[model samples]
Target: MRTRGTGDACATYNQFSLGADYAVSKRTDFYLVAAYQHASGDQRDTNADGTNGGLGEATASIGSYGNQSNTNSQVIVALGIRHRF
Candidate 1:
């Protein structure tokens, strides 16, 4: 599971995972998996040369759509192996 942004960075919504599979005979098998995730936030930018431009230019002079920030993070990894008859 993973999530981000929502009241004080939503506690960073971190995550981790792991898996494994093994078989040496009758066909052959060896599998492994792993996963990780991270999140962070606190850089809301209304766009003013601060980057993270999702909606900028002074809210388009009035339309209002200038506010985009990003600093969240994420990571994941996995290994695999299979054999079938």
Candidate 2:
């Protein structure tokens, strides 16, 4: 899909994600999750004053959140544990 942000440029991306969960007990669980994204099209360049500077290639920022990557593709992986009372 196409998306717009702070400027006139538009960007397109394809993302894939996977997640798994394992229950160790009635009160505990283990989980793992991962995501990959590739961005294309053009993006706006912003100046220090928040003005549109120019247009450039779009970079990947997984889940549309977190820090923007320097390249066109990005990967994210996370593992954790959860417990209940």
Tens-digit lDDT track of model 1 for 2-80: 5445543233345566778888777878887655545443423445675554421111010122322133443444566
Candidate number of the best TM-score: 2
Task: Output the lDDT of residue 71, model 2.
Answer: 95
C-alpha RMSD of each candidate structure in angstroms? 12.4, 2.9
Q: After superposition, how far is residue 9 of candidate 1 from its true place, in Å?
A: 12
lDDT of 2 by residue, 1-85 (tens): 3345554677777888899999999999999999888888888877999998889899998874687899999999989999998
User: Each prediction's TM-score against the native?
Assistant: 0.32, 0.80
Candidate with maximal lDDT:
2
